[model samples]
Target: MNPKISDSIPQEDKDFDKQHIWHPYSSMSKPLPCYHVKSASGVRLYLDSGQSLIDGMSSWWCAIHGYNHQELNDALVKQVNLMSHVMFGGITHDPAIQLCRHLVELTNPKLECVFLCDSGSVSVEVALKQAIQYWDSKRQPEKKKFLSIKRGYHGDTFGAMFVSDPENSMHSIYTSYGPDNIFAEAPQIGFDDEWNEADIEDFKRKIEKHHKIIAAVILEPILQGAGGMRMYNPQYLKRVRELCDKYDVLLVLDEIATGFGRTGKLFAQEHANICPDIMCVGKAITGGYLTLAAVISTRSVANVISGGRTGCFMHGPTFMGNPAACAVSVKNLEILRTGAWKSQVDTIEKILLKKFKPLMESGHRKIRQIRVLGAVGVIEMKNPIDVALYQRRFVELGVWVRPFGKLLYIMPPYIISEDDLNHLVYSLISVATDESLA
Candidate 1:
């Protein structure tokens, strides 16, 4: 938005957007202030206000390869000229075929079959449908209700919301709208805390007592993203897999947020060294270039669903396997294959840990606790923040860190430099320790 440049965009256009357009989780009548982003490249967003900001949220944690990535851009560009989109019902393309193979290679080998969809929520829907159909094929149609952990978030879709924490989540209002599902207590053991065997007891008991009725036991492995960005021990996931095996319950992992090297490992489930019966992947699938997600399942589950009463999976989105999205996704996996995210995440974690270390001793009453998992760093506040107040502050400080609920966190792009990261953390610390706001 440099007014001097011919390509610069005006900030006045946002007024029209604010009046007509509805943003995420906001009412159009009195929408939260919207920032006009004219363009973005790498880890920085160029605004219509002629100010540049270092992106900390990574556009809701999707653009892991950062914005306008060359390889992904080239892949998408090459695909659109051939064909932008086509019905994925019967027709297929090379992009979808290639992306699925790479997805299988990155994820669990047992999760060999991929069901491509438009977004993360749809992928969860596909997983739920797979579980239900698998049970029906086995003549256990009664086992339809899902069992999930408390404070866990899968997606915003009805099926996904039902299995998420019913009472605590923002989606709680829609609890009665979706299917009634079972929920175990949220794991109490912190990510780096001492192993608490008792933490598994409630989950173990829930599965034991309701195994007959539970269609699947679903949870976000190791790190639960939307559920307050909490991280738990990998042992909990390991034990969950064991119990699922013992009780004949399928484990569905929502790796939409934790997949693609976000949690130090390629997938958060890998921390437990276990494979899920059905796994959902999205977010970084195409390096945030386009909308895409996939539900990968075991060969047996795929066979059961295929050989079921309907003779086909019930759900089929029109844009299920978009060629352009798939093409970009193939290149995205190729980028991740370089194994650069490991060192990147390690460096981010170290920077967050070191920078936030002084804040712990600063004893800011507003900050409840500080936690870091891989590339994510969170400041759990004693109370929820005023979104407009903190957002304006972040923009003024030359960074973009969206503060929601009682959590102020940053999940930056993996390619961020040390100086950019330091500034990002500094911005958070400033917001957290700002005595006037406190």
Candidate 2:
């Protein structure tokens, strides 16, 4: 442990933060110690108090290349010197255009146009609007409903909350609206003994039943992030793609958490050789620098939303195409293109699997399932109580691992070294073995 940052922060600074700061996802009434970060590089976060913590969750799985990489910072600095902010509604800029070109090249060739937003949740909102409007343009306005897999998480925005599984998170407010636009199933990851041929047939039946009214089928591709890091077989995704096509439903792949090499591929859909009609990506798009999100779609889908005289996608944020953010995103993509991070991701996955296999085989009554995808790994505990205890133990051991209900998972920064990864795994095992958590 180290001295609190408040001890060193100027009295004025502390007063300002205390009076005005209200952080996202935090209970302001019961505040945690605020560690004022001095600087960060690689996978380490340095605090003003002189203590460092390995960013076990990549600052909520956004820092794909760790933090404060010189290349990314230089790109942002260069762009800021030229132009800082601009309304992307009527004007265009080099950074945004270049980033679009690069991202298109990196993604599947089928995806031709990219709509910029400021966050993953907003990108998903854009996708939902586009999908619904596409149906309206095609003279099928009745196709307004969206189907998402059970336990699949999209985001916290109203539109995203409606499409996500209701039981998983704090969605009571959205449900209160009695929105008829979204539908979902309990996640079927092909891991449970209960998952049999009947379950597959039932899922297909559900899709078929809703096919006429469904504008899109939204999912997290390979792994459901907030749905407890639950992973499903690629075959399931292939089937989903096929079913969506067969039913004339657009496939919306929310790669917000799984994108930018987090899943060992540039995109998660590549594992199944499937391309979605609409793709929502964010988190690491700017390498954890500026907030940026993109909604990419095929030319066919873009054309539907592109009205020559009257039709237009009437949605965008003020910071949608901020040049500085785009510049950082371009550099981040360049680093990913070099394939330098491939072996690093592979090493992490190997370490995770090697370390977690024993826990799975240990026949621990508390563990329900273990899942791994690329550099991501998860251990689904038997219940929520155990998950909470596991998370607390992890944070106490100098690693921060948040559990989603019963699902304890890690989506660490790709830049983490072997030693740090080993320490993380040891911490997890230690916590898992504790009867307190079990």
In every candidate, how many clashes are there? Answer: 0, 2
Name the 10 consecutive residues with the lowest summed lDDT in model 1: 1-10
Candidate 2 per-residue lDDT, tens place, 392-416, comes to: 4665576766665666677788888
**Model 1 segments more than 4 A misplaced:** 1-12
Candidate 2 clashing pairs? 150-185, 150-187
lDDT of 2 at 183: 51
The CA root-mean-square deviation of candidate 1, after full C-alpha superposition on the true structure, stands at: 2.4
- Model 1 lDDT per residue over 1-438, tens place: 112221244445556677888899887898987777889999999987678899999898899989988888899999999998999988988999999999888888898999999999889989998999999988999999899999998888888888889999979899767788998998873888888999999999899999999999989989888889999999999999999999999999999999998889999998889999999999999899889999999999999988988888899898989999999999999999999999999999999999999887676878898889899999999988899888888888889889888999999999999999999999999988898884
> How much does candidate 2 score in TM-score?
0.91
Q: Could you estimate the TM-score for every candidate?
A: 0.96, 0.91
Model 1 alpha-carbon miss at residue 295, Å: 0.5
